[model samples]
Target: MGSTMIEKILARSSGSDSVSAGDIVFARPHRILSHDNSAAILGIFEKLGGKKVWASDRIFIALDHAVPPPDEKKAKNHTMIREFVARQGIRHFYEGGTGICHQVLPEYGHVKPGVVIFGSDSHTTTHGAFGAAGIPIGRTETASVWALGETWLKVPESFRIELSGEAPRGVVAKDIILYIIGKVSADGATYKAVEFHGAGVENMDISGRMTICNMAAEMGAKAGMVPFDKVTEEWLSGAGVKEYDPLYPDDDALYEKKMEIDLAGITPQVARPHKVDNVVPVSELEETVIDVALLGTCTNGRLEDLRQAVEILDGRRIKSGVRLLVYPASRKEMQQADKEGLIGKLLQSGAQIAVPACGPCLGAYGGVLAPGENCISTANRNFKGRMGCREDTGVYLASPATVAASALEGRIVSPYI
Candidate 1:
């Protein structure tokens, strides 16, 4: 039997000819990612007697979670991180305003195909879009990597998700993934690697693929991946990646489970408040009122996402009572949107554009809702109190287009409508 992508990557990383799903190997990752939590990781590193990182050049840090430091406590944390970076001679550190770590890492050419990347954030899986095995590690684990330069990973069983048929009009990758998660439920793929393939995936762009993989964690997946292909190559090349040998699973690779989805008939989908798997068609919930609409995050804050929202809100204002917040994922993305006048159009539509940051995605700052309020957000996760507001506030997840259309109508409505 052939090895799956995860198996192959693990085998190479561990210098083994072959590895299987339950095999544990100590692998040295090509890159280690950490963000605002670096402060905490630094604390752990100190406790481990870590005077210096195993490899400063291999580590990437970004201050994104609370870009401007919403409070003095966070500001002091940033101060400590800055001092640590300077003392450690870390070359790839990105300060606030650089953008979310997930987006920044790829934009800076730190992520490459067939490489292993470990990050301190759950959305670390987002890097899998480039055909790398991006896994999330806890702060202490990250600290261990800093001290020892390697960590162990038990190769995960693979779940093959084959997507057939082209995505229908108005249905984006977010909708397709949401539908799958709804079917599988939140814990369906626990500790398994979800490998995507087939027509629907092939037809998706890097942004869409990133969106799908970013949310795989919500389904309890250890990682999510799309095979490297011309699309992946084109994206990397554009990002200044000169040469890379992409990796893919063999045609007969063994998989623990397999599933297929046909997207030709799939419509816009929404994950209602409090549960990401509580998905339903937008048409079924069009009458639900919303008090806020958020149009950016690591999940859907790329240029394409902004364009989708722009198409829907170009010359019209959002509903009178609704507040719209838009944020670009990275400084570069924000610049591109500004160059194309998307920001101006969004502002014309009564949308408030915030700095490039995580914003209210983690309830840290930026568009928190009040008790009894309802919000439709492009950010992943709608769990209770996720927006840093009253637990009574409801958060709904959807594609940027769906969010924009809903914002215009002040209620849950399909972009197709």
Candidate 2:
């Protein structure tokens, strides 16, 4: 009979005493997020007859996709965005190389518990790691949020997923989520708020939680969150975030569905080409050869993820048939890796290091696959032509450790050793 955290957050943002699944309410978001797509959104904003944004301070613009401007068109887009930012006096614009929008937004203390945010990118659900509801909206919707500061949302049915038990060694947040998606299927939780609960999620680091939440969209979740806890507090404190009202679900909160997963049963998992939900255990794909290993993205591109990959490589070089591309999610993560000597080791191991941009995660450039080449990547999606413009190429999704291990062997392999 109690409200779920998503319900509560929705109620608070909408200034409503109470809300339930299916209730449409106009909610004012604490922040608005857009990346390179801001170019398109700003155009829509102008088309909507907007002169200035609702609040310059609340808007976050980060140039990530096609960053460093892959072409003259994109370069002009960046130039236009810069001029628009100056004209609108938007205060939170992040230039190219700062990092992915999701990574840098929280680094700047923008994401907080109980706040509501809407980003133009699907991975906006990533912010739910901090116990805030981060929803993805379309470009037109993003433009509307920029102009109106608020948008209407239908409260989604909530599901409670309790994760317990310790995972096997080499198993990580990415593999676990992949396992869940494989079990639940792609559209399993469509338009539903998913709350990650129990010991497993609670024990995970903020980076791990971000990885889990970042992929929630793959399962069609409207929001994916873990309640705020000490881990959350510590990370935010490091980011200089002092005050936030952490919201928790009522003990008897009603859920549309409830399930429990034992992490002990999980293993390094992979999603084969063409779809995120087409997953299987890595053991099943031992002989699968790989031509590339991509080890970074918003999903698994953090200092912890980089460290995981480096730990697997361990003073070894990747095999001949494999070209390894390691992209830091942000400059902060890259700097931390550099400070810890992770970068030097990777270079010595022959892994190619790229900037903190999205980097072919959506095939925006920096690293793209050729026909007949297959890549094992830490990125979230592996849709056809996702990592390359050529549909003849293929992509396989895995954790950082798995990607690195596969790179070392020139084949799809688990991180068991």
**Candidate 2 local distance difference test against the native:** 0.92
Output the number of the lDDT-best candidate: 2
The reply for model 1, stretches above 4 Å from the true place, is none
RMSD of each: 0.9, 0.8
Candidate 1 per-residue C-alpha lDDT over 40-154 given as tens digits, one digit per residue, 9 for 90 to 100: 9999999999999999999999999998988999999999999999999998999999999999999999989888899999989998999998899899999999999999999
Give, for candidate 2, the lowest lDDT window spanning 10 residues: 385-394
Name the weakest run of 10 consecutive residues (lDDT summed) in model 1. Answer: 238-247
Q: So what's the TM-score on candidate 2?
A: 0.99
Clashing pairs in 2: none
- How far is 393's C-alpha from truth in model 2 (Å)? 1.8
Please provide TM-scores, in order, for all candidate models, with all chains considered together: 0.98, 0.99
Q: Write down the lDDT that model 1 would get.
A: 0.92
Q: Write the per-residue lDDT of candidate 2 for residues 11-96, one digit (tens) a residue.
A: 99999998998899999988899998898899999999999899999999999998788789999999999999999999999999
